[model samples]
Target: MTAPVTASRGRVPASATAGRGPLGGASLPTWLAAAAAGMCAAAGWLRVLPGTRMALLLALAATAPLLLAAASRLLRRTASTRDTRPDGGPRPPTAPPPAPAPVSRSVPASTPVLMPVPLTLGLSLAVAAPVAAAGFWGSPARFAQAAAAAVDGWAHLLATTVPAGPAPLLATGPFLLVWVAAAITGELLARTTRAAWAVVTPAAVVFAASCALAGGTAYAVTAAAAFTLGGVLLLRARARDLRGPVPVATRPARVARVARAGAAAVAALAVAAVVVPHLPARPRVDPRDHVTVPDTPLTGVNPLDRVSPWLSTPDTELFRVTGDGPLPQRLALVALDAYDGRTWTSTARYRPAGSGVPHAPSGGRRLTVEVTVAGLGGVALPAVERPVRLDGPATLAVDPDTGLLLDTGGLAPGLRYTMTSLLPAPPQPADVDAAPRDPAPATALPPGVPAEIDALARTAIGGETRPGAQARLLAAHLWARVRNDPGSAPGHGYGRLAAVAATGVGGAEQIAALYAVAARGLGLPVRLIVGFTVPEGANGLVRSGDVAVWPQVRLGGLGWVSFGPTAQAAPGWQAAPAPTAAPLPSTPPRVVPGAGVPTPGDRLASDGPLPVRRPDWPLIALIAAAVLATAWLSPRVGRAVRRRRRRSRPVPADRIAAAFQEVVDTAARAGSPVAASATVRQALDRVDTAIDRRRPPDNDFAPRQADLHVLRELTERAVYGARPLTTAEADDAWARADRLRRRLRRPAPLRRRRP
Candidate 1:
């Protein structure tokens, strides 16, 4: 006969177990982890500076869910305790009485996973929506605006290119999604022992790699370290929550063991991260010229057409020239004879400038400009207006109508050519008027000519009939009406000039185009030429900033004469660059410029061919020495780390298990290869097997065998049996395990697997 059971010595009431959910009481860690993930993701918003307001908003968005979870946890804990006592006071202890009969109370099983899936998803969506809305809608107040307009605005936000402005505000949506997904996945995986890697591994790799690729080196290293620390904390917390049902008396050892293992793994990963940057790069053939030169089509849209886009890169080396005589301030890429008010194109049929040398006035000096295509490439070679010679390995044709050079096959990087042009000699005023009348094609105006442009031209010229004087008057008008701004380049020359006339501001290119259009309106054969300008005093290095566009007028005797509409230089003969640096070496190696961003070295290394780089033997030797040293010390360092981390556990039994497990893992990493699923007995057997295979001396192995047996028995009892291990017993076990590990280390070389 059994007495009625009492709660004191029996199974706990059902209420104690009712709190279980799919996350299994792991809400605290889950929310914290989610917040951490969100913040890390937000750090990649854009390369630009995000102000203090944006940073605060990002922090609040990430932390809101965590704070809610914490508040809810506190409320539930308070509610649970409310039923235990009247004023939440602890129950008073009384004198011990005879123990009651043991009895069991039925507890309802935990809620099924099916319900929590939607709950978790709902919670995650609830958290993500506000963040997404903030990112898509920009400001919270904008929702009150027209619904249709708001929807269109949101669509536009999504379509915005990467690295767009408003920074963290634009990035919050993606960050929230990644965080919720990773945290939820981690929570689910946490239910199983050793399964946290399923979440941590992919997250770590993705975030770390993204930081490394998109951010600078310092940012990447910091991100990697932060990720490691966060992941370890999240994993440890989730693991602790899972062990909630285990007996408190025996839980410490297990927790400590897992904690030590996690620490060691993270330590090894962090060390590897630091070492990787120092490793010698693999040898490969160097990449040479692979320039993507923007083509100027037959329509004759000048380089000004690309100012809005192409001008972003100010350092790109376009070309390098070596000349027998003075180099011109500008080189014409192509000329347009037809203008439609907004743009220009050449409708005139291309004719050979000459079967041999093009005719130039008798008094001009013959000079040659040898150009190397350091970075430029296109169908047309940028040259002076009248090129009499095209000397290179390419077949080129000249458009006598416009004096534009065209290639049969497109030009490429490394292309070398020499252009011999008879430098322009100012003609006598009578000779210009006596020469053949300016061609009608050059002076023709587009349809619907703006009245204001014609009126302005007439007002500036003030009844001047001479073509040269008209050009000069128009140049003076352009310089006064339009201001030169190096920062802005207009896409449409004529439109830009019209705007400048009204707005009183324009870039050099726009001002030049204004003069061309106004001059043409007044019946002068004027056109726009786009090319580089050597500074008033230059050292032969032509930067992208040197590119300029200005007007040129065709006179009766003089070919196109540069009209200084923008005050780029004095109007005579477009003076040559003053000599500074010596000519480049005869033989230069092929230069591989930094991708997209041009460096100073993009300039020609030589006047001849590219130069070859010599290898650095000293750096190579230093790296090799470091590698050997790392290899020699690795095992010793690993052992010391393991020992220190193992002893970090406060519980005696836990310390013993941690020390033994460290050996098992180290042996596995060092090629013993024990599966996580292996039982204590099975793992010991593997250790014995590895020891036997490596060192097979029967008499000398007795002490190590004894230690191994003691460690195996003690660990099995500590982990699988109900008996609690005493402190003395735990210490003895640790000593034996440590001895066995030392013996394992002393044996023949262990092949370490790559991390």
Candidate 2:
């Protein structure tokens, strides 16, 4: 009936299977997609500048599978491909295949799945790990540390800033992620059918991760163009293969279909281009923020509590500073910012200090000082603020938020280190009106703060609205009115602070604490610092005599600026700042000798509090959503596999039987299940009645009554008739069953009736 099928009717053979290996062959389109995916994933290394040698190694990792697949295809030719006549041109035609023998059972054994390299695929991926590891390490000799390097890379990436290093350990994370994804995608391309669609998934995951960690914004356009080209090529190739031989008469229709698909894809990309650029930019949610490190060495220890003890033992040398230039004016041991009615503690969050030294605000002179511990029994190290670098004898941890340093391994006696610090420029006379309040509510007193202290703070600040001016007025008022008696007992608690505020007489520790609490009342955020002030013409030695506590008020732009409340001649609103400021105010020139210049504002707005950072909660939510989606879709995946197995049977009798089973299953899922024990005719009757009851007469539910009846008759003949099922009858049955599956999958469930 159909004109004898041949290669010459402007029609190609469905498959030149004789030329393909038994396992299958990778389509040219799949190869392009896998390679493109590998290249995109490899680009992720740009974030941390993984070196040149690593790039060559990664290229090898990406290409190895392609090379191996090509070799396998070349070496293992099918026997049919070699068969030819003595003329050396072509093989002669053979007789048609004989009809299949009649089958007693309704179904035969299932055919093999489209992909056939389970064992080989595992071996391929196993080989991929070390290859990727070698690529990351950049040397064959260093493979031993590959696994450890992968783990270390996570910490290294999070601890160090962008463009961290070309270090081997740091390159492992991106290498393993890209290489493993590429290897898996390669396997899918090498031996599969429509499964080629899955080739993009693994590579896409790696590509997305790379995009997330990329250092610059240039990834979007270039990567999109590359991926789009590969994806289009793959779609075009697979569509051609799925269509098998194209008949001349159907060529125009096929072109129309392809044009529609291409148009749809282009439209989707156009809509995305139009929409994405206009969307609001969201903060990058780095899992790095959630990485946990060792707690600070002085976690709960309040350095302010040590103030009275140090002053009591005035001559005890805690540490010594020697330098290449002029010595530092003072060294701050600790800044205690959090007070919860009782104890004041530093917000010390220590992580391994990799490269970034946190923040160093403008206006500072660089100075290098070497500090060597002497009798500094406490864990806190005496160091300058805004340290740029440290080269030391101890393992150090630094708080990226506070620029606070800690010796994780313990600050033993005689421990030595050199530090680079930014010493702030002197305060200007006009600074009083320039600075604004940056009150950290966390530092202010809670509901438990006494009323009289709050009232005194208001009185001290008076009519001064400017933050810097209010701070100066408050400090001057304390120095003039409060009497510092060294004999005053050592508590700086709420009761002790209130006692000192009322009596106007207390040790320096109590006065400093009172200053902190009172400053909070004037709407100025404050913290207490315990440190030694270097005296004029001082030698290298720093003693407990210099251990005085002072209050620092945080201003909007200038950060924590220290005021000298203990200086005896600190006149009200007259003495503006520390000793290094311009010409002195109207007050007497009795400024404390060798008082430090204003400490540089190290805590930038970003470094102030974790709340200021947009929390990466959406990442956690995405993880949860992925888990739920996986659980929900798992059964669907299993059903798809089963459906493929049922639909792909090669034997005519088996195909007919599987077709009937599929129709019954589809009916069951659609809420009109037929009884398992029912006869073939009975099952068809029930299915027919259910379909008629649910589907509207004019609607698009496929397999009209006549087609379903014909499928039922064919199924009956395969299962119960004497003759073997024919290929024509089997095709008709499967076509109708698939149409039914489509019709049933839509539409919400109705009143479910049990079988």
Candidate 3:
């Protein structure tokens, strides 16, 4: 070998390749690295927003040809550079050897690098096919409307004439055909250029951003963070590659140090962002909002035994009675002998009979009562004294003083408790007593006792002589003469009883109280009964367990008769001749007083039916769990079935070789300068070598041989005579190969397989 080329210092020129950069040029790697970085960033972003990710993915899929074109451009550029000498002149070809057999290089693993574009485009189309079909056939108008709504500024630009009827071929048919054509073209370009990542990255980024925006801030933040982290990891990987080789010991130590530093930084940031702001002082909540004190007293461990007039309203319902038997004449809760301004307290401490239950009175007609109760404030079922017998399922106790049944456990809704109320028949006049000493507290006359009240009481009973008759006469007069006008008197005034008695007018409670005070003051054995009044036309009743106050006075040994002095004294009392007429020899018959017809007091006592029980939580939970399980399993099963089908069918060989050739040609066109004598396998091998040499092909010339395996196999079968090829098979092979070539020339990532 003659004289060797030498450098200026007299050293041989080594190999003319000594000063060349990796891959023979600087621009290709720079561009490819930039494109790869951009693609990585875009893919990261796509993971953040679902809708945007879907849309971009669809668009990328539709434009596969463009990606292939880019890959081909890259390959061509790369090849051109490789073919030229360092000084820029084309290298001289060596003389051909005589009688040489046709030779082909085996395909290399790296050939897939040039296939990104066409592969991405094909995948994009495959992915979007179903969506496109849905949009085309199933309510195209609705689909367009939804898309328009999702795209904020472009709504007006959207076409409104959706393919409605079937006859006009010009409508959806042509549009769909064009769309399919565009998609096919894009796929072909992608296969040829292998620049799939270039096409896919932007679409992915846009899609991710859109999804993030649509999902709201919480979702957006999480998505953005995840994408950012992925991008950082990619960057780190690229950086590591750029750093070149290092001593094994030093490399391990450096990697460990970096990892530790990164971990500490992450920990510190997490603590700062999430853990330090909730430790400040706060004000205490008010005690009144937490608890309520019980103002009424109880007996026999029943909370409902006590009745406070202050808390009682005239119309509040206490119970409801429903049965074939007549309703008990009077639903009495408790009897109070003493009165303060707001409440009635018993004058004497109760003395329980032998078993703590009040003993029945000696003689009286017994009446049965069935009661249902609701609400949560009480635990007692009220009834008159001397009940013959109690039935139904419920725990019963008695108030020692009032001799009323105190139901210990709160009444359940729809509960039916029975009681026999003993009503004494009207006693003979001779059997009645004149008067009895009062055991109750002395009445306290507040300032301004009305003069008329005393004079009226005196006038009505003065001539009667007998204490019992006098009490009855006075009650009858007041009930017949006074009007029950809530506004007839000045503000419920300071002297409540005195004022009401003087004016002969007041609210139901005030008037009732006056009647009680006046009757008791007359020396009759009178007791104040606090309970609700039943009104007319009340269809249903809700037993709130609330008690309303009224008065009950004894007529000698004849027993108590329940009546509302306030109601009788009201202005409308005489509008309808008393519900019953006085017994007269001349008159035939009249509605009996206090018989079948419900009084105003009774209506007030019954409101509406009560509920049975609380809702069941376990049944609801079980149903929810079943629904979730079904939802979770459906998609997985579908995917598995599809995968099985794909595995069962293998691709033909000629198609594989054809696809390989397409990728090689696309790469060459893209400036990657793959060897002409190289078979698809050889080209793949060269790509692998290039990658191992840390010189990735240009983005446009990225290989896609992995995706084109089926096409390559088919091509090999056709060329090597492994199998007979039909015209359709040849066409398919060419088409697939062409598509793969375009994809290899593009700058985007290869697309995923379609479902």
Best prediction by lDDT: 2
Worst 10 residues of 3 by lDDT: 156-165
Model 2: CA > 4 A from native: 1-33, 45-118, 128-174, 192-197, 210-283, 288-301, 305-335, 340-342, 356-395, 412-452, 463-491, 499-512, 521-755
Where in model 1 is the C-alpha error above 4 Å? Answer: 1-38, 65-119, 134-162, 167-193, 201-222, 225-621, 624-755
For candidate 2, lDDT tens digit of each residue in 1-755?
01111111333333332113333444565466567656755665554454577677666666676666554554444433466777887877989744232221222222123335666566665666576555655555565677677667776667654444556676776776665666667666545556656867776776677665543334555666566666566656654544344544334434655675566556556544544454444444555567764445464356777666666677788888989887766677777888877667787676655433544333357778888888876567777766766666425666655566677776777888777876555444466446777756545576777776777778877887887777776776777677777668877678887888888888777777788888886778888777666654556788766676777766664566676676421112122234322212211222243432232222211222111234356654655575567556654765676667666766786677677767777777777765433445556666676666565457543546666677777766665566777888888888988876666655643653332
Q: Each model's C-alpha lDDT? A: 0.52, 0.61, 0.41
lDDT of 1 by residue, 497-554 (tens): 5667777566666666677788888778766666665443454555565666656666
How well is each residue in 1-755 modelled by candidate 3, as lDDT tens digits?
11111111122222222212222112233334333433333333222212343335433433332344445556654664465678988789978633211122232222333435456545544434444435444543344533333343122111111111121111222222223433443333223223333323443454353342223334344545554454454344333332222323233335654665476447544543442222222222322123332222444422213333323333445567654554443455555666544434444222211121222343455566576664423554556444545554424444433556554455666666666655544332233335333333344433443565567678767767675455545655655655555334332233765666665556555556666666655655555665433333343252332234565555422345344443322222332213421111111122233332112121111111111234344654554465467446644554344323322223433233333443453454444545333344445555443332332356623344443454545544544453566656656665655555444434532331110
Report the error of model 1 at residue 213, Å. 8.4
User: Can you give the lDDT of residue 515 in candidate 1?
Assistant: 72
Residue pairs with backbone atoms closer than 3 Å in model 2 (clashes): 314-545
RMSD of 2: 12.8
Which candidate order results from sorting by lDDT in descending order? 2, 1, 3
How many Å off is the CA of 503 in candidate 3? 2.7
How well does each candidate superpose onto the true structure, as a TM-score?
Answer: 0.41, 0.53, 0.32
The root-mean-square deviation over C-alpha atoms between each candidate and the true structure, in angstroms, is 20.5, 12.8, 28.8
